[model samples]
Target chain A: MMTYKSEDIKKMNSIELLKNLYQLNNATMAELVAQTSFSQSSVRSILKSLENKGILTLQNVDQSSGGSCPGRYTFSKEHFQILSVFVDEGTVDLKLKDILDNTIFHKHIVCSLNEELENIIITITEKYVVNCISIASSGVIQDECFYTDHGEYMTKHEIALNLKKRTTIPIIIENDVNSMMMSIKAKQSCNNLAYIYMSETGIGSAYYVEGNIIKGHQSFSGELGLLPYQNQTINEVIASKSAKEVLEDMFVLILVAVAVTIDPEKIIIAMKKDNNLSLTKIKEGVSKSLSKRYLINLEKSTNPLEDGLDGLHYLGILKLFDLYTDYNREKRNG
Target chain B: MMTYKSEDIKKMNSIELLKNLYQLNNATMAELVAQTSFSQSSVRSILKSLENKGILTLQNVDQSSGGSCPGRYTFSKEHFQILSVFVDEGTVDLKLKDILDNTIFHKHIVCSLNEELENIIITITEKYVVNCISIASSGVIQDECFYTDHGEYMTKHEIALNLKKRTTIPIIIENDVNSMMMSIKAKQSCNNLAYIYMSETGIGSAYYVEGNIIKGHQSFSGELGLLPYQNQTINEVIASKSAKEVLEDMFVLILVAVAVTIDPEKIIIAMKKDNNLSLTKIKEGVSKSLSKRYLINLEKSTNPLEDGLDGLHYLGILKLFDLYTDYNREKRNG
Candidate 1:
């Protein structure tokens, strides 16, 4: 089966053979020739080139089938590590994963908003030789810098520049909600998706159209909290509401807006893990406002934080693959 | 010098040569070779093929460059005509446009919602041999059928099927608001655009993001009239308002919603030609609600009917091009 990682790999024909090998983890020359459309000699040449670049290792696995069993090739596991970080208001979640998306290290650190984020990142980098780093945070990110809703210690670009002084690796900065939506898109096959993050502080939204994120003209497409509902904005109503009836009414109103405006195939609501919000009243209210044909399938996120981290990991893997392809191209051109 | 039509033409190499010939009307072979990237032999071959297909005529022109004079080519004047219809509640506006989008014939007829649309279409089609027919109507269109706010005599599919039985030409059915947005997109270069059509009866919105329309998962996007505001839906408020102050406030509220959510580069408001609505109060209200950073440049449409017709004409041209390309490909393949 083709994964999201393979989807990016298939864009460049030159990398497709190596990408298939990497996805298979361990495959014989005969197996690769059968799997790919490339001729046997082209497959052999690509494998030899990858081996010369130290990207894969070839070894004989068996000799029972013929006079000489085809050798098995495996991608270099030690060279595909990625460091991912998910930053929130007062906490940071760190993860390290391999090319196959296997988590090698996971840790959670509780710190104040004013804590030295650079020091924490530097400490993690000192412990691992990651090919790429990705950070997902809450706010509007532009020009490699993040502008949070409240405030932050340093801009993402500043931190990236600081990290660059110590290590020479690519770093990517993405919005948290955008990251969560990306994770959902990577896992699902739906064309249009609206991921609404409703929490105690505020409500935000991110939309996915045909597997691409809709950031609007200024990257503010899904600022649902600013939507006015019944005399107050959506966030204000959510924050002030203490009665269950009011909350249900507010959810219904917001859902109606999303339904009529976006008409997404699926609506994924991301709330706090401890929050006990029922979908019954929300669905009932939406049904009253919209026809059943326009209704969307509603779902609650099981682990939004994990989803964000997985999304960051996937982004890091893409960056790493891009770097790998660029290096291969430069070597060939030179 | 490349307009949107030229942009579409450049996608297919074969069409680019023919389109350049059409755009230039009559251009010498030397001028064509100098202006286009094709080799002289290639240009001659394309011109020969087009002439053989009865699309263009070649004529000798006097030398202006003080060298050997080359023959000029012009597209056949009578070969490309399109029938366009804009359907409203109690009337239908019909137009016939040539290849250059010049109106050849236009008429506005008083027709009830329950009128037999087929007879009217047949009446017009009998007078002209059109290459394509395009219908733009006020409704949500899906699978060639339109679902209107109120009952109509025939769904768009029924009308299209009826027309197809009479003529073998291609037919396209598009939402009116979507057509308006398409027209705006063709004339402008903005990456993100949101067009809102506000009349005494209802309001509809259409969004253009990165040169594509956002039709949502169920093709129900941009249903702005359903948005609830001030104890009622937007349409109800628009209907109940007799005072100018209330109308201004309502427009401001809707503008603010669009401003913060979509962050569009431009917002076009389409009102009735005689409506005495001013933008000063609407702008002030939006500025008060949203930060200046999120304020969008607002403008009003000068001639909405013309814009809608222009949009339909452009769509019809695209359909005609598709049919032309398909025919050529089938001939070659066979």
Candidate 2:
């Protein structure tokens, strides 16, 4: 199924170079050549074309290495802006970021799903020329919609339909756990990885195998909270009682479930910082059940909110590239 | 990490064509051109070169559809012969397969692992020009060595080393569950798949995500038997008593674990043909816990042995290509 030839590389050379360049802080023609394994002329022409189109900017760094060439190139960060909306049970946080991931605006509100989301987008779009919207929610998200949990008053809600009607920009709606996993993977670089996130919105888990997220045959592939425990679901056990009380057994069981199934290298546990869940205690409990023969890094997320946003921002960049970057044709800027 | 370009296509073209051609029965030049996006001339020249090298045979059939063209080209199945060895606790089965996957010879012996394997290879090599050896065992297999279950007299065995001393051929040692999953996947074609195989060798599982197998952070990724149950490992529970006694609750818990983790579309259950484990009972048990909101196909393997051999054969074919097929360089015959 993975059949391919070199002509594919020749076709996708410019896109690959641009994408690789975007990943770096700044790159030289020599660096680009090494990074892409393309000829120096190919990198030179592509960068020149991108600079002419205002997609990239040439920074005149005083480096004697490039005696006869232009200075380093920086991907024009402000070329495309992203509005990342993170919605949970009782809170909504929005950050307007440039293509370079520089936050231009930030706001938070106490609401579930209402006109407030549309208002936030309007507020952000009014200030900055946003190119895409990335919506990361606590519950399962399908297409441009979000599906909340059972027993919730508002079960389903449209994510960015109002904004869609007003703007021709692209939008992405994704499950919080999956997006969280993506960003954490960017940091951890764990090919086979699992993610567990817990907060006021409750707990959710995601599985990443190789380079792809195992969305399963279903949308809710990582609904760990729905797993059965002692006469109650995992969510019920945590919801009714202090999570600390049943944390050991719950954590160990989750370890077993994930470790036996996907066997990820790192299982990132993202929790609300104020939840008072001790990492040492959790590790001690897990170590008692699992031996050191197999090294599964069970660690806490440094900052759930920031990491989730990172993932959302990366998704936004990908969405923007999908919408605008067509190397086969003329460059279309929104 | 997945940044790639199309020139990769130009380099890997003929190899891709040969690899793809091996998967099919026979294809006309038109079909080959369509299969590969390459122009008709590119396909024609490649096929002609392959036909000249005796790697492919041009067949002539009485059909007006081809017009002036040769009927079809079948990959020369006799290009390479592979020795597939299946090792279990009680018995070991060996089959000699051609590149086209035809069984050239077959033999079964009542043993786990010993010098008998090397002797059999020596026997096969004296008659047939064997090019590769694929060893599929019940327990964990790493590198060219096979690690058997605990309490077994022979825990570690060097697989086909004595024969390797005689012939410079490719040899692969893989876990049986993984091989079983590969072949079942070829039939089922489930993108996200989990395989549970129950035979005299005991219960084991393998996970497949996207197009890659989740071999875990460790080599023994699919050691499902080691999972904790009621006061005993899942393997110990099944080993100590009749699997039928603990089948329902055991199956239910497994379903809950796998469903909550990597919610594969299909969970293939391969059991011993003689064991009277009813699918109805297993399905009823699983459905009691899991709701109808999501669908997961839990079916039995029609023939575990045949499916596993198919996977091994496919692996053998890939190994042959890796060792012999070089589109950029002159053809090497061993």
Candidate 3:
């Protein structure tokens, strides 16, 4: 754990300045001074330090008169690379993206239950200079371990430990639904949102509150399938549904429950591309059951698999930056 | 909205220091300097400012040898009073508590459907010199206004606005379940908790994540009555059940749903004193339904009404302190 001290305040201020520069993309000394309350000398000193650390680059754009202008500071685009993977029941999709959002590699692999996960990860790492690895799967993850609700993979932590031994980079294993939620949160401006994921196997949910995903105490949040309804669980009803109206009714009940409890700004239903369901019908059915004041917007996800992969990539990049920040803090303290 | 500039940083540091002093109750200058990373001179400067503002008092503690010793700084208690009220369907319980947690007055009044809420509030305010008022009711609260789920009250906001005209103190209206949750959070150390408030009217829930309450987008995050279960909602099942076993079964299903979704560390069932159900049976029933990994501790609230009132008082005091901080900042800027 890190404790904030008076000395750390200056370091924190520098980090804030660097974050602003990252967000700004390119800024001159005068623009930076105008953007922050820090003195001009403080801004210059911090920028020079970042430049020395190879985190930022300074470039001078000359005017038509040929006179020297203040140099512009820009964050390094290719400072790190992240390997993100989304694992389904029988298939795995992998993508390696740079800090600048460039996709360098993409691959999909179909694997059997007995396949060696460690060897597959090692082979992928040998092909790229990855700084962090993030994998999304359908399960409960805690303390770098995975526990499946219905699966045969018993040595999940052993696989994670084996991967850790193969590389010095950090490994983040997250639930697939949580990954999709993060992806949606990254793209939307709403502070409170809920993502409902429906698949042939079961239905789950992920809540986004003020930029943070609510994973709950044991990482078992969003298990909507466990909800008992109509003398049976939601999963049983959905699985046994014979008519479209029955399915729509079940959805309406779920939506009404979500609206009345969470009252999110938007409810996103994430399904496979092949599962065609009209958002309009579902929204209309839910609206009739709820009061006007409690009506919420409902939409369908464009691409859930891609969103899950993107969420993994985003989380991996965040971990890489956190590592960088911690390394710098350690260097400063030393 | 507030932005953090260099000047605000100084003010934040002062607030942090003051909070530490408030938590510590009393400490010498050397002790304060040792506790924080700030310099001795900085500590002295902040303490002197607080002393001059009458927020803290300095006292000398002599050594055993009868010689002069260092002075101690203590936060002044009883600086303000909070008027807390819990409004039920037909009755209102009120209490006036000081900043030091002392209850100065308590009253219970029965109200009819057509009674003017502003007059009741005015009658209470006339009995005390209150700095703030906090009301906990069974409704959806937003923007300091109440909205009942099922009631005859048409203009809840108008009533609140009218009360504002009669009293100059700050007023806060909150959901009763949220208040109970807040009170429990204040007294416990659990980071993740869920409180299930069960009454004859309906069943509601409150989720506590980290140090903040999850109020959702519209402050309707815990209306469990809307959840569909077993050909009816949880509220419907509980309200219609006449046997203890039936109620236990319903509780088991609800607990399983909560466990699979939120996975809270502890689930506190807040029921009226007369509604006696065995905790062991409910725990056993839920554990049998869920896997061993999802087992959670279940407890009963000792006093729901007191907790609600205390929560109101606590929130009112917090708002008061926030107001003090903002006022000081404005003064400094002026």
Candidate 4:
């Protein structure tokens, strides 16, 4: 076990301390001491400090057999707080979550990606209780992780550095498509997958293998939009905001491509509630295209398994933020 | 330290033993004792008995301090072996490798897939000595995991359960594209990647995320060939034999679509060695297509990253077998 001396425990931030407790599986001090990579004495001090703040509660367990005195400990989920913001072309969703991927609070508001975009972001962000923010937009985010007006394309690192000045909490910016991919990848059903998030505005993808998302060179891989469809237009297939275009080209790009390679056990498509008609048309078209392949004798054939996510859901956002934190920690440490 | 008593160990087939050893990182008795979930003494006994046979070796690391006792251990790579067979439409390559991924021996021969396919597979396989055997091909292989084949449209998996009667080595069968994807995904350089492999017959893809290959519903995914290409077909653009069609359609299907969606940090194009002229033409065409999009910028602008693999390397077959075994074990235990 790593020996966390008393002084270190006293100086720890709420985020760090919460992670420590979470690592203990929400167990009490005695249980934590046995399970943790941290030393026993340090766990006791941290537990006491958290309890003093009224952020935790202690419950007594039965006495240990043959022991002179029974053990006691404090526990808390108060440290589990984070703010997640997902920004799209004209909207941003803010959410607060606990470490266990439970939502505390959330709100959504419409906004423009105009010249005053930064100011609008700050104004909207002030409403959330959680300060730990992560943003996913429709453009390329640079290494420092800042967005540009250019859709899904980061201008430079200077913009990211500038954004850092406005926020105290570490802000992680990513592409919206990639975020959804990471979200599905973290879910039990989509454990090993190559995701295709075909939205009305554009197409996005996230590749997951070995329980990790593939962020290619400069964290810019899985740009499925750039992949060619018919007539030299990749977006025409999966990203057309026009329902007719989406219906016309969906099968040629998303479904056929997905069916042929990495035959993912499941494919989850995210879209708005009203787009069911377009989605149905797409499903039929794709099934027809796949069936045309004479050699493909599927043991069973069904509509490419499709699921929808209401982008406004707090549970989904909380899960997204949790995954982002997990992603960041893995990269930073591993 | 699974307290696998001698009886449990005795009950295990060679494949099971190899899988356990691989997961253990081929450790020695002492190291295994410290790491396993099993009892320390049980591990020590298992190591002692296995070492007694020629199955494994325990070597001592010389002490930096002269005259000190040496620390001894075993490396799994030194003890395990794999026989890999790569079958093509008209040829086959048979080889044996140690767990360290070294080829102990190899043989290449021409054979027609249309004639006596099973007999040819058995004949080539008989020449190797190994604990596990994996085969990959270009077509869709059914339930049998004995052999793998690649093709112009979809890949297949077929396993020869009867092979157990011929050799103690476990047999793994998979599609060539999936196998290659697994191989690429396993490489530290290409972890979490969307890779494009263009061979003589067609274009295909394999995706890696979080160190896992994305195997879709039919156990076939990464079918880039089905994604349409303008001017010519996708098959023409990706397959080695369709030089004219590939050259003409390269810009329309590959570069533009790749840039918009699956924005891979590095787009690796696998081609044939002698097809340099066609490759250059395709590059020029793709560059012109990609230059139109500002976001289509790649670190290697004019020259895309490309490598050539042996037509019958069957790299993904070996990897998919390992992944499947791990998945199977996790499934059984869970």
User: lDDT of each prediction vs. the true structure?
Assistant: 0.71, 0.72, 0.72, 0.49
lDDT of 1 by residue, B1-334 (tens): 1112222332354565655655566787777777676777767866786688676777767677567666778766566788888876678888998875567889888763233776777777787877788998887776666666442243444577667778777889888887877777656557788888876677888887765777877766787777776767778877775577776788887776665455678888886664667787788777666545555588898567767887788677666655655543554688
The DockQ assigned to candidate 4 is 0.23
User: Could you say which candidate leads in TM-score?
Assistant: 2
List model 2 lDDT by residue over A144-240, tens digit each: 6777756424377775676688767788888878888778765554677888887653578887787787777766477777666776767777787
Each candidate's fnat, in order?
0.45, 0.59, 0.51, 0.47
Writing each residue's lDDT as its tens digit, candidate 2 over B58-170 gives: 99873776567556888777777888887766687788988665789988888766776677766777888777888787766655677665542437777656557877767
Candidate 3 residues lying further than 4 Å off, grouped into runs, are A1-52, A57-75, A111-127, A149-154, A236-246, A326-331, B6-52, B58-74, B111-129, B150-154, B163-168, B235-243, B326-331
Sort order, TM-score high to low: 2, 3, 1, 4
* Candidate 3 CA-lDDT value: 0.72
Here, model 2's chain A TM-score works out at: 0.85
* Local accuracy of candidate 4 as per-residue lDDT tens digits, A242-304: 556544465345556546544445555545433444555565566555544322311111211
Candidate 1's C-alpha lDDT? 0.71
| Count of residue pairs whose backbone atoms collide, per candidate | 0, 16, 0, 79
Residues A97-131, candidate 3: write the lDDT tens digits: 87667898898888622336567777878977878
Model 4: lDDT equals 0.49
- Score residue A272 of candidate 3 by CA lDDT: 84
List per-candidate RMSD values in Å: 6.6, 4.1, 4.8, 10.8
lDDT of 3 at A252: 84
Model 2 CAPRI quality: acceptable
Candidate 1, residue A132: how far the Cα is off, in Å? 2.4
